[model samples]
Target: MKQHIRLLKTYLKPQRKRVVLLVLLLFGSIALDLLAPRQLSLFIDGAEAGASLDALVTVAVVFIVLTIAKQLVVAVAGYFSEDVGWRATNALRADLADHCLNLDISFHKDHTPGELMERVDGDVGVLSDFMSLFVFSVLGRALLAVGILGLVFSTDYRIGLLLLAYSLFVVLVLRRLQSVGVPHFNALRRTKADLSGFLEERLTSTEDIRANGARPYVMHRLSEHVENLVRRTRASMISARVFSSVLEISLAAATGGVFALGAWLLPGGSISLGEIFLIYYYTQLLSLSLIVITHHLDTLQKATGAIQRISELYHTTPQVRDGEGGSLPDGALDVTFDAVSFGYGEASRTLDEVSFALPAGETVGLLGRTGSGKTTLTRLLCRAYDVDAGAVRLADVDVRDLRLADLRDRIGVVTQDVQLFHASLRDNVTLFDATIDDGHIERAFAELGLSDWYASQPDGLDTVMVNGGETLSAGEAQLLALTRVMLRDPDIIVLDEASSRLDPGTERLIARATERLLKGRTGIVVAHRLATVRKVDHIVVLDDGEVCEAGPRERLEADPASRFSALIAGGTA
Candidate 1:
């Protein structure tokens, strides 16, 4: 409940004027609805008294005008309500997206992209009813109920007091049932998210699944998820049915009691015929008002479940927080790893007490077999994960003391697999940044010897890469990736097997581009090919998570007993 109230204030506070207008219009419409009952009672009394036809016509026409005005006000109020809901939820979606982006990479590892999408988009969609209906329509119904009782009191206080107690009883009962199905709905939502994640994972891996003859296995797993979804959905539906049945019983009993009392009072001239009719009519109106609330109550349970999930997401603070330190020094920056130790979750250490350094304007080649912490080293340098022990420093200043944005801005990373978005080549190169001019991109392609490749495109940078650049070959993607890094002109460059994807034909082109890229920057090359690391100033060899050897590349190559020399002789590096 507190979370619900907090969300309401956070979103509704921005649209103050629309909210006020909606409230006035809604209450005005309710006033007209309530007055119609009174007008009906007046008509009944006038007919009983044989009042003139002209007088009756005037009252009838007034009632028709009231009805029409009420509809117009309601239609306008609905527009405001929907507009407010869409605006609030869209803002919330943007906030959620930004928040998720800032969270630790580990958080993303636990949740699939599809699940996150559902949380940010689908769960918030459920709250549209809560935001639009709960904000004003719920209150309008309550006001309508009160007005019904007020008119009844003017007719007769006895019925007024009885109906008030009934209203309270219905409210209490319904409120209790509202929470009864929320737990089921929450579980149902989780099953839905899991289903989405499963589908997305399978769809993305379609080629691998088909090539390996694992389509049958995939379908079996999908079936299991679908079965789980059905079970949870069934449970939620049963709970809702129970809630609706109870509401129906309460309404039926209340209506019967009102009619019975009105009949008893009509005898012995205690209340006039028109008075009985007015009481009955208001009682029916009150029942209809409660029916509206009952409908909202059902949606409220679903929205409550959604709110619980969204609140949890908002409250989740990231482990990696921005530092309060000053900006890093300009120009090429030396990189340092001092007795660093780290692991993912409860797993054994990935980089254990490993240490190395690259002087400014120099390059170090990292030679390591598989699972030797080569990638983890680069990750630590980029501050993707903090060290469990010791520190990663730039220019001898601990990275933990630097702002994350500034730290990352000065370091560039190029990986074997490049992720391209479905956008124009220019947008992909500049990452949708309009600040970078076309000349800079063209220059980058030239520096990397990709000018011919760029020109081959039908429309140059304006050419849209279809489906995440699938049209580009593996070698072409690497060329584009190198050009992207060169454009950034970072102080430090980490190439994690960046050339592993290039064909033999593009090897020299990539090598020349890499040499140019590392000219004045501190560079760390995680290499599997000796030719890739042969030109580096220094070499660091790793076995397991520890650094086994470190020295000047020429000296290490000269020493046959060195680990770097042994790896080269064995054709491992």
Candidate 2:
């Protein structure tokens, strides 16, 4: 409920003027409708009193004028309501999209893309219906109901009492129905999210399913999700239909009772024929008003479910954020890990009191087995997650004290898993930066020995790479990833060197490009091949996050007692 109100406040504050105008238009339209029946009553009485044809003509003309005025007001109200509703929803969706992009990486780890998309898309759709119809309908019906009751009372107190009692009963029924609807709709919405997440996971892993011939298994799981979704939807629809039925029946009962009572009172001269006729019209108007109220109630119930879903996302705070009054150094680079110990929650430490330092402009090689904390160390350098304990510093300034952007701007990372978007090659290389010209892109590609590959493509730099397309081979893809990082040209580079088996020719090419890219720049290479270590200035051997040995590569390789020498002798390098 709090979340729903928060979302409403965001849109309502911006659209208060439109809301007010819509209210005025609805009141005017309903007033004209209620008054039109009264005018007809006067016409009927004039006819019974032997009035001339001119009197009937004047009454007819007034009725036509009132109807036309009401229609014009209604049309304008509908147009403005829709205009404000869509505009407000668009603004909200934009804010949600922006928030998703800036959220912490761990947030993505916990949520699927489809779930987020549904919150932004489906949830906003729910809000749109309420803003466009339910909100305006509620205001219009309230004014119409109150005015009609007051008008009825002016004519006959007994009739007014009867109508008011019936209206309260109908209202109570609708309110109870809504109370039941809220929870059911909320259940339906959760099922929708589940279906979305399930479908997304399957689509992303379609190739694996096909390769493994697990079609039957996947189909069965999808069928289960679909069945659950259908059940929830059916239940919600049944509830709505039942509520509408009750409202319709109650309206019929009230209309009949009003006629019976009016007939009895007319014999006592408590009401005239024209008054009885107008009372019937009032009862019909009340019925139509109740129907509209029921319809809007269903819409409001659906929106409440949606609002609850979206609010959950907006309320979540990211685990990672910028530091207080922090700034980056304006120098080459000096990275140090002072007794750093880190882990994922409650798990064994991935990095345990690991300490090391690299002077500015020096290249170091990090050798470790899988899960030995090589990538974890690079993640720390980028401040992807805060350290569990100890400190990582650059140029004697604690990383925690540096502004997030400034800290990340000084470092570049190229992981083994390279993800490319379905966009033009130029966009991928420059990361959509308008300031990076073709010449700069060309230089980055040329430096990485990818100029020929780019030139061979039919569209050159403008060619689109499909998502997950093997447009570039393993080595070529690694080279392009290098080009991406080189475009940033940060002071520190962390390379999770590719483990793909490269031919002699491709190996030599990568070695040369790697040397050139690391020249006079501080670098840490998560080395996969033994030859990669020989070229580095220093070597750090890690075993389960703890540093086993650290020294110049030649010195470590020469020491028989060293972990590096033992691994070399064991032919595990």
Candidate 3:
């Protein structure tokens, strides 16, 4: 409850002006609505006393005008309230996106993209509607209820007290019932995210599922998720319905009781007919307000659940902290890993006390079997994950002691699985960095042997890549990634099997590009093929997270007993 209130304050603080305006409008609307009941009573009593036609007509017009004005105020207030709600919710959405992006890769590995989307977007959408209702419907109706009760007491204190007692009773019952619904709503939210994640994962792998003939299995899992969501949703709905029904029944009984009391008192001259009618009218108005309040309460409960989930996300601390560190030294930076050790969570170390160094403007080849920590080593170099022990350094300064932006800005990474957005070729090549000029891009493409591919495009740099670069071949995507890296011109480059996905012809083109890219930059190549690393100055071989061989490639190749020689002989390099 405290967390929800804190979350509300944090998001709503920026919209105080709108909130105040909405409240003023609520007061005006409620005043107009309450005045209509009095006008009706005055009309009825004046008619009973044979009042003038002109006076009656005037009251009728005033009542109609009041009704229209009340609705207009409500409409204006609702619009502003909705505007404020969306602005605050969008702020929260942006914060969530930024937070998720800053979290460590391990955190991302534990969660699916669809689940995070549901939490960041879907949950906030629920809060938006609830916020609007809270500002307009809940507050406005609550004030109306209080105003009616006060007016009823001015007419007849005894009946007003009785109605107040019944209102409290109904509120207590509904509050208790709402407590039962909150947990169910929370569960329902989780189930919905699970369903979203399941569907997203399945849709993304549609080809694999179809080719493997696993449609039945996928459908069964989806059905199970749907069934779970339905059950929880039904439970929450049933609880809310019960609360609404009880409030309706109780309010109806109270109205009947008031009517009976008024009838009995009228004969004794304890109350006038107008007063009886006033009390009854106010009772009905109060009933409507109570119904609105009850409905808003249900919405509030669901929003509370969403707020708790969102707060949980906000409270998640990133394992990788951005240290207040200095910038890197200028020029090509030598890379060094001094007895580095790391792991994912409680798992065994992926890089166990590994140590190696490459001088500035030198190239090193990393040869390792699967799960031998080649990629992990590069990740550590980039500070994607801090070392569990020892240090990774650039130019003798620990990577952790360099500002994250500065460290990453000077290093470039190209992986086998390239990511291309659905955007224009210029945007894809620059990755939306407006500072990269078209001339630089054109030169990079030509230098990297991608000019022929570029010429084949009818729209040149304006051509749009669709469906995650489906229009381009795998090798083309890899080349595009390399072009982006070359444009950035980082001092250190990590090529993690960047040419592994290309055919022989494309591989030759990429190899020529790679050689040009590595000319003046320090390079670490995670080699999947021995031929790709033949000209590398140094070689490091890993077996079970330990460095088994480290030397010049020619020397390792010359020694028959060396791990690199054995790998080549076994055709495993």
Candidate 4:
């Protein structure tokens, strides 16, 4: 509950004045409702005394005006509540995105993208409703009930006492029931998030599911999840609804008792006919308030569950960040790794005591087996993840000392897996940067040997690429990714077998493009193909996450003791 209050403060702090205004308006509305019964009682007494028609008309007009004002205030409060709710949701979503992007790589590895999406999107949506409805419903009704009870008690003690007793009983029972059912409803929310994540994962992989003839299997899993959600929802609804219905029935029975007692004591003049009517009206208002408040209590429960999930993402801190007062590097670039060691959680170290130095303007090849930590080393160069021990140096400064944007800007990467968003070809190449030069785009395509294919597209640069680059073949997507790096023209190049996806003819084009792209810039090529690696100025063989051999490509290939020599002989070089 404290956590929920703190979370709500973020929403309320932005609209403090509006919240105060809403409270004042609602108080006025409640005052009007309480005064309505008093005015009617006065009119009844005046009519019995044969008051003038003009006096009655005046009272009636005042009643109508007050009712209209009350309704107007309610409408305004509703509008403002919705606006505040939406703005809070926007703030929450933006903050969640920032946190998700900055979270530790280990967090991302543990949670699926779809699950995180459900937390940030689906869960936050529930909070929007809670913000808009919870306060308005609960506070407004509670105030109304208190005002009416006060008026009723002032008019007649006997009837007010009976009504108050019944109201307290109903509220206590309903609150207890709500408390018991909250945990169940919270469980229901978790199941719903799971359902959403499962559907999202399956839908995104629909092609693979169908191709492998696992449609029935997938459907069975989806059906089971849905059934579980339905069962949980049904049980929660039944318990809450049953408790609410029983409270209403008990209140009705108690109302009958109040009237009977009032009648029995009527001759003694403890209560009157008019006071009975007022009590009935007050009881109706109190019951209505209770019903609406209870409904939103359920909503509040769900929202709290959602807030818990969103808070998980909000609280996560990134493991890797810039050093104190970091800034971009300037001038000639040199990369050095000093006894750097790293590992995924609980797994064997992927890179162990690896030390290396590459002077500016040198091409280096990282030769290794499938799990030899080649890609991990490249990620460290970009500071994608910080090392577990030791330091990575760029231009004699620790990599962490450089601003993230500055570090990423100075390095260009093309990995084996190419991911393209759903956008125009030009957007993918320039990444929607407004200041990219047109000449750079043109030259990038030509340098990557993709100018002819790009020109043949329906709209050339403006042509739309479908989601995940599904419209283009795998090799074409790889070329587009390469063209993207070419346009950037960074000081350092990291190519993780970007040409492996292409055909033999396309491979030759990529090789020529690679040579042109690497000129006068430091490069790290992680490749399995012998022909592709042979072009680099130097090669370093990696085994079990350590440097095993190092020399020029030809010298390493000639040495029988070298791992690269063995890999070449095995046709996996």
Candidate 5:
């Protein structure tokens, strides 16, 4: 509860002025609404007393005008309320997105994109309802109920006391019911998130599912998730409806009791007809207001569940912290791994005591079999994960001692799996960096021998890549990835099986581009094919997380005992 209040206060602080104006408008509407009943009572009493027709017409017009004004005020108040709610929730959505982006790769590996979307968007959307309805439905109705009670009490003490006591009883009972329903709502949210994640995964893998003939199994799994979600949702709804029914029945009984008491008092002349009518009107008003409040209470319970989940996300601390260290030096930077050892969680070390170095302006080929730590070595250089022991360095300075953005900006990586968004070709190459101009893009394409490919597109850079780059072939995607790396112009480059997807024709083009791209720059090529690394200055071969061979490529290839030579001879490179 404290956390919920704190979050509300933090988000509401920026919209304080709008909130204040909304409150004033609410009061105006409620005050005007309450006046109608009073004027109706006046007209009733006047008619009974044989008052002037003109005076009665004046009261009738005033009553109609007040009702219309109250509606207009309510409409305006609702507008302000929605405005504030959207702004606050949108701000929260942006914050969640930024926080998720800053989290480490391990965090992303543990959570799917769909689950994160639910957390960042779906949960915040629930809070939007809570904010918009909170003012009018919750607070306004409560205030209106109290005002009705006060007006009734001024007319007759006995009836006022009964209604007040009934309102209190209803509120207490509903509060207890909400406490019981909250856990169910929380469970429902979890199941819904799971369902969303499953759907997203299945949708993205539709092709594989069909190709592997696993559609039936996938459908069965999806049905199980849907069943669980339905069960949880039904349970939450049942609890809410049960409590709401109780409130409705209690208010109905209270209304009957009020009317019965007013009848007995009216006959005895203990209260005037006008006074009895006023008391009955206020009683109905109070009952309706309480009903609205109860409904809002149910929504509040759902929002409470959302708030708890969102708060948990906010509390998740990234395992990898950003460094506040200085920037890297300009020009080609040497890459070094000093006896580094690291693993994913409790798993055995992926890279165990790995030590290697590539001098400034030198290119090295990292040769290894599957699961032999070649890719892990490149990941360490990029600071995807901190070393379990020892340090990774650029230009003799520990990578950990450099700001995360600065370190990543100095090292460019191009992996086999090229990720292109559904955006314009220019946006894909520049990654939406507005600072990169057309000249840089043109030069990158020309230097990579993609001038003909660029010219083939009628729209040129403005051409939109759709379906995650399905518009381009595998080789074309690789070329685009290379162009992205070239445009960044980083000091050090890491190519992890980047050329494995290209055909012979494209491979030759990329090889020339790679050689030209490595000029005066440090590079590490994690090669699966020997031909790709034949021209590299040196080679480092890893076996089971340990480097077994390291030296000039010519020397390593000449040595019969060298693992690099054995792998080459065995045609496994």
Candidate 6:
């Protein structure tokens, strides 16, 4: 509870004036509520005393006005509470998203998108509702309870003692029930996240599932997951109901005592008719508070469970963090892998003491059999993953000692897989950065010798594209990726089988663009098809994660017995 309050303060602190206004409105509503009952007591007492009709009417009118004012204040408080809760939770969600984005590739690989979505969206939403309820549903009603008890004690000590015991018992019992309920609800939330992950995976692969005739299998598995969720949800509800049942039973017992005591004391005239009504009505008010608490108790437990999960996520420190903020030297940086060794989390080494170098402003082709660590080398160059041992140096500066942003800024990578968004062509080309001028985009296309292809678009750069480039061919998507790299004009660039998916005509266009892109830049061109190998100054061949051959491309190709010469003859690596 202390942690919950602390978190509320943290998020609510920025909107201090709104929160203050909300608190004032809540207190005003509670005061009106408390005052209304007092006015009712006065009206009854005045009527019983044979007072003038006008005096009784005035008291009744006052009670009506207080009731109306309470509702109005309550409505205003609701608005402010919701407004504050929404802003705070949205800020929390944004922070969580930014944190997740900074996490390394390994963290993303371990978590499903759907699971993350549930954490960011579902959990935060629960916290948002609970935040609002904590103010009015819990604290405001608590004050009302205290006020009711205080008035009762002033009138009669015995009744106040009875109701105080009732209140204390309810609190203690509900708290115990909450401790037992949290685990079940936590399990329920995890199951929901699992279901969401399963659904997201299946939905994304709908094409494969339908084409492979695996629909029945998918449906059967989905049914099993749905059934598990249903069972957990039922179990969770049953656990929650225990709190409600306890409160109802306790309320019935307390209400019986208040009625019995009121009747016994009424006959002796020890308590006036008006005073007796006040006690009964205030007892009813106490029961209402108990009901409100009972209803929100489940919410409290859900929020408690959400906070635990959110805390765990918040505390997760990323494996990849910024280095000592070292700066890189300007323009066409040389690349080096010095005795580098790496593996993916307990797997066998993918790159074992691999050593290589390329002079500044020179292009090299990386040749390898499948799983020979070609892609891994490029990833290390960009510091997507740090080396397990040894250093990846650019311009002779150790990459581990440089800030990731600074290192990556100078090295641009265009992979074979191009991901496009559902947005305008300019947005897609600029990756949603609107600051880039159209003139630069035109210059990039012209440099790539893609002006003719660019002009063929119905709306040129303003054309909206479908998500994942479904509206564009594979070759066109790759071209867009090249355009992105061209725009960046980094000191170092990597191309991963860039021309693999194109027709001969598109291949020529990409080859021309590839030549333009690699000009005046250090390049690591990965070629499985050997189409781009002829353009490189040097070649490095990896077999089983060790460099077996590396030399000047012209020298190696001239040797009939050399691996590069054989790979060129075979037309593949």
Model 5 lDDT tens row, 335-440: 8889999998785778889898889989999988899999989888888889999999888889888888888888889888888789999999999999999999
Whole-model Cα lDDT of every candidate shown, in order: 0.85, 0.82, 0.87, 0.79, 0.87, 0.88
lDDT of 1: 0.85
**Model 6, CA-based lDDT:** 0.88
Model 6's TM-score against the true structure: 0.95
2 against 5, candidate with superior lDDT: 5
What is the lDDT for 182 in model 1?
86
Candidate 5: where is the Cα deviation over 4 Å?
468-470
Off by over 4 Å in 4: 261-266, 434-440, 443-449, 468-470, 487-489, 558-561
lDDT by residue for model 2 (1-573), tens: 767687778877798898788778777788898988887888888888888999888997898888888888889989988988888888888888888877877788788887888888988988887878854487677678888889889889988998899889877887788889989999988788878988899888999999999889989998998899899999999999999899888888888888988989989989888888898898888788878877777677888777777788877776777777465556569989898888876768899999999988898889889788887888888888878988999988898887787888888887667777788888877778989998999988788776776788789789886666777666666666788888998889888765346677766777777777788789898876777666888888888999988888888889999888887788665
TM-score per model over all chains: 0.95, 0.90, 0.95, 0.91, 0.95, 0.95
Error of 3 at 464 (Å): 2.0
Per-residue lDDT of model 3, residues 224-335, tens digit only: 9989999999988888888888888998899998999899888998887777887888888889888888877668778878989999998899877776886676889888
Model 4 per-residue lDDT at 155: 68
Model 4: which residue pairs collide?
A: 528-573
Poorest 10 consecutive residues of model 6 by lDDT? 1-10
Best candidate (score: lDDT): 6
lDDT of 1 by residue, 226-313 (tens): 9999999999888877776777788788778877878888877777777788888777778877777777775777888898899899
RMSD in Å for candidate 6, one decimal? 2.0
List runs of model 2 lying over 4 Å from the truth. Answer: 474-477, 497-515, 531-534, 568-573
User: 296, model 4: CA deviation in Å?
Assistant: 2.5
User: Which 10 successive residues of model 2 have the least lDDT summed?
Assistant: 323-332
